[model samples]
Target: MAHERIEVDLPLAKVYELLCNPVHFTKFLERIDDVEKVNSQTFDYTTTIGGEEFQWTTNIIDNLRNTRFAWITINGNLNQTGTIRFTPLDSGKRTRVDFTLDYRTFFGEAEEDLAAFIEELPVQLKKDLQTFKDLAESDTFKDEESSSEKVASEVA
Candidate 1:
């Protein structure tokens, strides 16, 4: 089990919106290669871990708007469950994100390597969280989203 937290200079709703979008994972997470929606609440993804690529599918178990996002791996090399919670701070101007991951390490015939990977999981997760922070706070992300929404509204 690994737990991590980070505070970001963004509203809870904004952060929650990012988390709820599965496609955003491929964009923000360095290890993620692709994210394909399987259904409304499920996605299939390819990710690189320790220089090896793994294919996985996950189902979104809980999605409490602007508050929490949780998922469990349905098929993958490892069995995993994770949750991310968003809490508003500074009167809803800032958000505190808490992330938790619980997983069983499985690396085919490479048992020894799994130990090292497990030890590094926390650091990797923290880095991923920081990457998310940098992305959410970036002007390019905001501008792109805003313009896309504007175009969508115009088309509608």
Candidate 2:
């Protein structure tokens, strides 16, 4: 299991909106190569780690609006489950994100390999979280959100 936390200078709903969309993950998560939405509640992700590529399908098991989101792998080479919680701070002007991921290698893997992977997981997760923070705080993200809202309103 690995855990990472970051505070973003954005409203809870804004941060949660980005987190709920798998397509946005590639923008912030370095290891993620691509994400395909299988359905409203499921997604397929392709990622590369240490020059090795992996694919996984995950189903969103919990989604509590701007409060919490959780998912578990349904099938693939990777066995993983993760949860992200959003906490509003500064009276909803800011958000604190807590991310937790638990994963394991396939059976029969070398013990040393598993140990090394575990040791490096936290460092990678921290870096990814920082990237997420930067993305959430950037003007590009804000502009994109505003544009999308305008488009939606026009369509309605």
C-alpha lDDT score of every prediction, in listed order: 0.76, 0.79
Give the Å error, residue 97, model 2: 0.3
What's the CA error at residue 155 for candidate 1, in Å? 25
User: How many pairs of residues in model 2 come into backbone collision?
Assistant: 0
Could you tell me how far off, in angstroms, the CA of residue 127 lies in candidate 2 after the best superposition? 1.0
lDDT score, candidate 1, position 107: 50
Candidate 2 TM-score to native: 0.81
Question: What TM-score fits each model?
Answer: 0.79, 0.81
Which stretches of model 2 miss by more than 4 angstroms? 110-118, 142-156
Q: Which ten residues in a row have the lowest lDDT in candidate 2?
A: 141-150
With a 3 Å backbone cut-off (N, CA, C), the pairs that clash in candidate 2 are: none
Candidate 1 lDDT (Cα, 0 to 1): 0.76
Q: For residues 125-153, what per-residue lDDT tens digits would candidate 2 score against the true structure? A: 89988978876788465444333345568
